[model samples]
Target: MPANRAFVLNSRPSRETPAGPHNFRYVESDIGEPGDGQVLVRHHYLSLDPYMRGRMNDAKSYAQPQPLGEVMVGGTVGEVVASRNPRFAVGDHVVGSGGWQLYSLSDGRGLRKIEGGTPMQAWLGPVGMPGVTAWYGVNKIIAPQAGETVVVSAATGAVGSVVGQLAKLAGAKAVGIAGGAAKCEFAVKELGYDICVDHSDADFGDRLKAALPDGINGIFENVGGKPFEQAMLWLNPFARIALCGLVASGYDGTPTPLPDVRVLLNTRSRMEGFIVSDHMALWPQALGELAGHVAAGRIRWRETVAQGLEAAPQAFFAMLKGGNFGKQLVKLVE
Candidate 1:
């Protein structure tokens, strides 16, 4: 048996944000060989996402609270070092919910084998959950028509970036709202957005309104605060909003004050919140399409990778505050 290092939730956050490093306790324990029907995997990359913040709370929500003293939940891309199951073999690469650990033991449930054509890290970002989330929200929910305008907040983020790109692929004008000037530049120059507004600017609302003179027909709402409220002001008739995330308020668990619903009623606009997991039926289709886009280089993605497993907490905290660009990940192995 070899020692496996893991991060466990030691205390609940008093607020919506992570309680700090003191709340996560690192422990090393002996990992036995895989039992019959199980596989032992060595994690290479650990995903850091905003949604994990909500799971730390004791409050009621779509998913249950993360139990105290248990390994923190997260997505991981790893290699099977040993396998007792016929379905998986040594040296196989897999994607699964492997938690915050150096290694994991699984029975192949919810595990998907990944091909080697693309970077393994891509399996956690563009061609994985975030990409599928964007695909479903854009193609299925918003369904923007050509020449329409679609606005997305957190535009440089994993999901938001893909949302903008997908909108452009559909011949729609994609507008982005991001935190700083650099991200705004990347959104327009690299992601092919028509325009990107810097939320940090004092005149952000004015800028957003100017960019979409034709009004917004669809919205991929990622940050649900004033940016969302501002987007509401420019809704075209029959506008659709795919409420993918609320990273703005997720950290503090604060209630987001919404704009008046009278506008929505007058415009007959639609706004719906979605959990990607709830739409399991669409995963295969979404992932397949996303994979093709990524493989052909039609989709460009960036990563802010922390070097080691020990760096996961800081990397995760920075991601919550918009400190990282693109997808946030922890590279656990060389």
Candidate 2:
């Protein structure tokens, strides 16, 4: 039997990204066969996100942090190559927390079977984790209504793009804030956001105010930094903020402190931070509805795929720096 080649995090990363010995190691090791109640998966695509940055540190969080020298954690779409479980069979298409590796051994917990006949990459984007993040945050959390105004940071990302569209479907005016003009343009033209503001603009705060004359009813808060601080001033009474990933603060060398909580209190609004892991039971319902929207031409998505496992680390860092156009995925194999 051939061994699986895996990308394992070598050490705790610094803000500038630890280089050489401080970063990652690729090693060839035995790909263990499935034991009873387990399945052997050949990973096809891996989803990369800023949240994984937190997992690298030895700190407490919503989930157990990844230990040093373990396979770096991530989500992947894989084919069941060998199964020791009655619930799965050979060639089954499933999604799991398979990490940055060519193969994974799972005991069937936290595994989701993908159907709907859509392209597999869609599962890594709109029909998968990112999509669910967008849907539940907007519909269930934010609860935007017709005539309301919804704003989203990281507007061109997998979750933000879906967030903007789902807001529109609920009859609200959707506004997007992205890094540059090109991304802002895509948010407006491709994603159907009512207004897309460029966060990189010199007068971005002023521009956002101009685009949204009315106060915002809901905010899909993904990137938490300057943009989040600025958006805070524009929220209306009873505004709901679905605080997802803090991509901006997560990458900074020094920790970034949030603005005053008095602002949230003054506006009579609520901000809730969540991990999708907590909402696992709602995922099937979310994915089913999101895929139906995609099939019906209501929600759409895009992806930037790096061709191989070797490119995973680079692609991940690029995504952190706002280099990816849409959902960032690494093609691990096949």
- The best candidate by lDDT is 1
Candidate 2 local lDDT, 1-334, one digit each (tens): 4589888877776646643334777788999779999999999999998888767765667777677677988989989999999999999999888999999999999887888478877888899889988988987789999999999999989899999999999999999999998999899999999999999999999998998798889989998899988888888999999999888876444576778878788999998888787887898899889999999899877889999998988888888889999999998765
lDDT tens readout by residue for model 1, 1-334: 6689999999988845446767799999988999999999999999998888888888898999999999999999999999999999999999999999999999999899999899999999999999999999999889999999999999999998899999999999999999999999999999999999999999988988899899999999998888999999999999999998888875566787779999999999999999999999999999999999998888888899999989988888889889989999999997
Candidate 1 worst ten-residue window by lDDT: 14-23
Model 1 spans with C-alpha error above 4 angstroms: 15-18
* Residue 120 Cα positional deviation in candidate 2, in Å, after optimal superposition: 0.9
RMSD of 2: 1.9
Q: TM-score of every model?
A: 0.98, 0.95
Cα deviation of 41, candidate 1, in Å: 0.6
**By TM-score, how accurate is candidate 2?**
0.95
lDDT of each: 0.92, 0.87
Model 2 ranges with Cα > 4 A deviation? 14-21, 251-253
lDDT score at residue 93, model 1, on the 0-100 scale: 98
